[model samples]
Target: MKSREKAVRMTLVAASCVWLFGVPFAAHAQSRVTLSGIIDAGILYANNSGGHADWSTTSGQLTASRWIMTGSEDLGGGSHAIFRLMSPFNVQNGHGTGRAFNVAYVGLADDRFGTVTVGRQWDTTIDTVSGFASNETWAGYIGAHVGDADNTNASFKVSNTVKYASPQFAGLSFGATYGFSNQAAAADGSSGFANNRMMSAGAAYARGPFAAGIGFLQADRPDAQPAGALGAPGAGVYDDYENTFSGSIASTAGVQRQRIWLAGASYQFFGALTLGGMYSKTQYRYLDATALTLDNYEANLTWQITPAWETGVAYIRTSGRYSGSGTGDAEPGWDQINLGTEYAISKRTTLYLIGVAQQGRHAVAQIYGVTPSSTRRQLVVTSGIQHQF
Candidate 1:
């Protein structure tokens, strides 16, 4: 079956190429490819990182800096062959964060059939509903939920995957993805196949300055394991969801199974102001007799004072609970506020400032990519510049 599918895709690409270029297989020049990238950096100060005021230089302040190559070959019948390769990097040290082609994929596209791509890619939730959150839009990860429990700002990707995106119809579209485990036995000499998969799907609608989306994602055996376990020579779960706030209270190591669902919407008024909000629920089932659940609610507003200047503010509340098999239950809630502004130096360059403050009740505060605070409250301020090429 897999081989048959591969053959079909190849045939489609070949047939489309022939029809688009109107030339023999060996002679065609109807393809276009382009390279693009963004570079962003900032000075960061945290009032209480691990109990000390710290200052440092950071990358990806406004956006995670990355380069990409995109190409498309026109197919005769309103169809095309497409591919993209994206590489994210850290400017502070001039190092690539992951694989060279961390977001690489090749696929076929058509106006009527949408697109189908294979290989590593983002899950459905981030692709669909994350735009409604300020964390993903204006404030960066500094405004994201702790540990990125919903995968909005985390280092999570699906491998060995096939994804489908539906063409828009009346401002509505949908997508789905499945990641294969591609593994054998577990580290503990158990069957790993039962708990080694990931799946996600989502839908979105946009019309007349209003947009909304709903999404869901789930993963099995998401917890980290001991070294040389799970048929791999590692101490972490195979295909693990990487968390930036590891060692903090928001870490996901205790989770064995994970699931998340989200809904979000946005609206623009008078062509200058925008309002948006998102709600998400994340559940973590642990092997240590503990279960964790988080409910995140957020709202934000953005104002474009002029073509070159913009500002925004956002608020987020996280309500969480922990249940132990025999222990007890606890409620840990958190409130966060985000403020930011941007001034465009040119069409492809901008300067920005962002501030985040959070107060936790019965919870610990940790901003993504920064050290956790020792107390229940934390603050971070950053100023940065970004350039695109």
Candidate 2:
């Protein structure tokens, strides 16, 4: 294990050196490094959660507060080397106790060929079709589909991954990624082929005022590891990634595998209004059991009332189906509405307001990062501020 760890570390060091110093001998390359991030916090009111009206201070209601370091160097021949190191934190507590870099990758890019990178990073749903989903694009995790089952809001990042993105061709682009377990055998010294692995692929199109995307993702054993294991140093399988949004199926629900497909599209009108819609289906296959399926539908509109002010409203419907051995089929559904507005205080700062109302039928209400409601209804209202640099 130590030998493997040392090897991976050495490889990363070499790659970093190449990206930093491998410029052409005489081309006079130019390099740039930028520091950037967002900080957001607010007060939230919930009508029902654990059977009570609750009020609390919240962080990342509009965006996950994060800091990032991004750099790129021109390598001549229209190619460039790039890298990113991003860290996410809770602004309210000002503590970063988990993984050091939420995203860490090194890659090369060319206008004509494409780009390839390796590290912990987002999957295809987040890269492609998620852009048209209000919960992921604008409304935040609080507005995400039940348990974020489809990964539009990204339940977790893929670790030990290599990714490739193709250059656009006539308004079309495509990308894919693979995640590894980093271990050769299971605890019992057997092949770990079915333990931990992830893969995703997606494509997108944009032309004039219309854009659309489609994506597919599959992940195995996201929560196979126990708690108190994610924050440890060195390399581990599935432990280094945070799967906070996967509670519905990943938290001892006996889920063994997951698969998702999503598609979305949007249209712009008169440079002031945008309309978008998305659809997704996620399947949860359990160990020694049948499977569960979740279907989600969403539509939203964003209106730019002015250059500094904007508002968005969206509606979502989610349905779940259960199928198991010798068991009757059961179906449950949930409906949600989300409303939000943002006023730009400056180019890098804003004040925001958001509200969501959800109701479930033959289901329990569960919003991301919030306590599950005892009844079938939940409502959340939040007012906050965000700043970027």
Candidate 3:
């Protein structure tokens, strides 16, 4: 009788142990924090039509180096709280902590409802469709849409904003954002910095292998000029080649507004190859002035040579036109071709090579504030390695 009783107690203890530890372990497995980052560094060489051969070292030739921290806590009943903080940096010098300008936000997520975020963030057009083309991968310097003409990749981050994103269903999702001006009225009974406020909104949808999106952003011109000039005649306004120049006349004075539209599609041809293309356009309007329009198109192909090796080729073209009082009918345009290859040293490291060449017309001439000459052509070659953790 004593032996039998002891056996029964042992069985009960084992069952209690399973019940006490199993549920908590399963829940912990479903919630966790992840730290991820990438580092890309490379050497670069450039040749220009002016008989200047420039050899320079470069990094992040293929993709920007960045670090991200993300976490999610399950609230039970198919709901959760989530947050993410991502920072992009210059691998060469290890400075610039906020390339995305300090994206820190918190939101509630649900399996059925969607998500809402309040803080500094990117707009919908960029989050839905950017860097889907080969040009972004192959051409290092020439890939951006002519001065980031469209801001398609969220190159322009929004501040003091509230945003909402819908849950993806059947491969389709949508979102919108609003930024508050937060200003006080002026004594002249006129709007002061209040006029300098901004507002933006956008929507997007995706299904299967196709995606499309559009967004509009607007900002008021401050009476006081910021240090830099926009669309200036002799300044490297968009290229970041020179220091900020001060001017009295606001290039985008009054009310500044921008509208962007984009569409893209990708398809897998076989087990190892994929093809994709994208088109985007942006129109900028200055208070009572005619609009300036910029157009872009890109196409690319990627091939997997082996399980760990890949190569790609891409082409991109862009055109810009100005319509207003003093501007002439001349339009500028540029063409770029790029080739790139990559080998995965491991799951966390990669080596890459990229070559890019660009030829510009009237637009390229204005880009450098120089007369139109074949000497405007630029070629760049780069090779680097990247590690992710």
What lDDT is obtained when candidate 3 is compared to the true structure? 0.58
Error of 3 at 66 (Å): 2.4
The worst-scoring run of ten residues by lDDT in candidate 1 lies at: 1-10
Give the Cα lDDT of each candidate: 0.76, 0.76, 0.58
Task: Tell how far residue 368 is off in model 2, in angstroms.
Answer: 2.1
Q: Could you tell me every candidate's TM-score relative to the true structure?
A: 0.86, 0.86, 0.75
Candidate 2 yields a Cα-based lDDT of 0.76
Report the error of model 1 at residue 48, Å.
Answer: 0.6
> Taking the tens digit of each residue's C-alpha lDDT, what string does model 3 give over 112-205?
9888887656655555566465544444433455656565434445555677888887777777766554445555666544333445555556
Point out the higher-scoring one by TM-score: 2 or 3: 2
Q: After superposition, which runs of candidate 2 have C-alpha atoms over 4 Å from their true positions?
A: 1-29, 225-253, 325-328
Ranking by lDDT: 1, 2, 3
Cα lDDT of model 2 by residue, 297-385, tens digit: 99999999999898899999998887876335668789999898889877777898888889887877777667878999998888998
- Model 2: lowest-lDDT 10 consecutive positions: 1-10
Off by over 4 Å in 3: 1-31, 49-51, 97-101, 135-142, 185-255, 287-290, 365-374
TM-score of 1: 0.86
